[model samples]
Target: MNRNLAYALVVFAATAAAAGQAFAETPTLETTPFVSVKTRADVQAELAQHKANGVNTYSIQYNPLKSFKSTAQREQVVAEYIASRDVVAATTGEDSGSAYFAQARTPHSVSRTLAGTPVNTAR
Candidate 1:
């Protein structure tokens, strides 16, 4: 191969790599509590209180275009809604798209009640 051609190819590869990095858009999914509870008002209200007291926002990291964009956007929008109501603290799926409110924690105990029945290792 010609020396100039080889150099050009190297430059092209580097440029492409840089362009990929520049264009890549990663979606950040941060969970926050949902405001306006009418059905599960009592339970969610308590959860909201706990959230204000400082809780973790389960951040779900993913690529927007190369990964799931819609789901990430949804999560972010929900986060906005939560913020509108001045509620915080949420648990998003680290890699999964699943999202839900995080209730108060009870350490080291496996069992919990979902509605009335005892559920193991979950709140």
Candidate 2:
């Protein structure tokens, strides 16, 4: 009978400890109601402005560039593309232009005054 009582006491203490830990880990939430910062009229005015600017929020065929007009001629655009072709290729190649940039870099020339050594007095 004493052994059974001690076992029951230990089981009860373990269950109470586990329940207390579970309760401690849970946080009580404070509810705060939302306050509107804009009036209905202001929201309607903004929606009207967006519609006037050709912004269709609910359209399935929305095109942002529908009203775009090109200022450059086709020949000028082609020439610009051709001029930058080599650079674009080098940068986008498998090596990612590291070799091309390394080759293009020029070594810095140090002047006598900045070389931290005395210049020739004979000169």
Candidate 3:
């Protein structure tokens, strides 16, 4: 019984040592050197410059007929669409020497059918 207890203690000690080593090796959250953290004032100044350069902010309109699997997916798609539109709008505004305001409307959704029956799922 003493021998068995000693062996069990040895195994437990080795396991704990390994676990501690692994835990020490685990990466901690560290700020990346390449990433620059901008302050609120800096952000406001950048936005002001963008606006002064004739970049007008606009709303993104999603198609009512389109079906999104989830709100997050819809938001991601809309964000990407808006980013592209902003680039175009900024260029246009700069060329015209005036701020251009416009709403981006998503294209109509593809027609979905089930068992030869057309489904109108518009939310």
Candidate 4:
């Protein structure tokens, strides 16, 4: 009985340690950016460029989740939050995906989808 209890505790302790590490490694408020910019572009441009380069696809990725405070300065915080995401997408060339965010002091959360297209200038 003592050995069994000890083994169980060891397993639990290991799991707890792992979970704590993950949380600690997660991005902090200061590390995460608060401004972003993106371009509405020709998606096919990537496809064509990749093909010409003998590749099947070109892709970019960014963290889709963002956090903000909904305190008295909700609008300011939210604006910065959204801008930060735009910058990520533009910098990485990530063109698709949505945002899932939560306020710092409330249960309020939001999800928003972004779409874009490049204007044809050759005409």
Candidate 5:
């Protein structure tokens, strides 16, 4: 009985050591460089093509009241925005246009509870 107990303990310790060594060997990852890289001329040609695709106008909008601390700060923000827009328009052969606003729907079009009655929520 003593010899069998000793044999069992040795087997268990050897199995545990083998498992630890097996887990210690980690596999390494290999990577390759990109097959094709774009050059400066390639990027320029792409931009020219984009310009020819009728994407010639852009618009910028900002809420100055929420973004700025005071009127002077708001004016400075607007000036900077206009300057940046002018720069992009000149460089890309595009024009800066007026700000766009989505049209709001009438109250009757929107769902509302009328006179303590349940409204139909399904479309």
Candidate 6:
């Protein structure tokens, strides 16, 4: 009787596992293959435009820094960085600034519960 009971339990477990797997929803994939809207000439024209713009992306000696120039003055950039230094440090801290932001008095930090009671002055 004990052996028979163990066999029944094993059969039940196998059936339950198989049913779980068989009833699982499968992702449906698109049947149609992809088709390109642009012709070979369109691609060639785009490459030509990039070359005209002095951007040689395919070249091994490509350097974006060669043409880069900052619009902001050095003093202005340094001042802006100094102002945001504390905020940046807090955000990148161990707790990811959750504690700092929670205590922050910014407009976005105002909780919905603290929005104050609505007043009706309709006469």
Return the number of clashes found in candidate 2: 0
Question: For candidate 1, lDDT tens digit of each residue in 1-123?
Answer: 699999999999998888864476789877886776466888889789978956444536433345444646778998788775532333434623234333343455555556866556686
Please give the CA lDDT of all the candidate structures: 0.63, 0.86, 0.68, 0.59, 0.67, 0.87
Query: Considering every candidate listed, which one attains the maximal lDDT?
Result: 6
On the 0 to 100 scale, the lDDT of residue 91 in model 5 is 49
- Pairs of residues at least 3 apart in sequence or in different chains that clash in candidate 1: 110-121
Candidate 6 local lDDT, 77-114, one digit each (tens): 99999999999999999999998888786877565643
lDDT score of model 1?
Answer: 0.63
Instruction: Determine which window of 10 residues in candidate 3 has minimal summed lDDT.
Output: 97-106
Put down candidate 2 lDDT per residue, 3-65, tens digits, no spaces.
Answer: 999999999999888886434566777699788999999999998998898868679888878
> Each model's number of backbone clashes?
1, 0, 0, 7, 0, 0
Off by over 4 Å in 5: 1-29, 32-72, 94-123
CA deviation > 4 Å runs, candidate 4: 21-123
For TM-score, candidate 2 versus 3, the one ahead is: 2
Least accurate 10 contiguous residues by lDDT in model 2 = 109-118
Every candidate's CA RMSD: 24.0, 12.4, 22.8, 25.0, 19.8, 7.3
Residue-by-residue lDDT tens digits, candidate 5, 1-123? 999999999999999988874346677866875666888899999999988865544624433344455547778998999988855655455322322111234666777657967577677
**Candidate 1: minimum summed lDDT over ten consecutive residues — where?**
95-104
Question: Could you tell which candidate, 1 or 4, scores higher by lDDT?
Answer: 1
Better of 3 and 4 by lDDT: 3
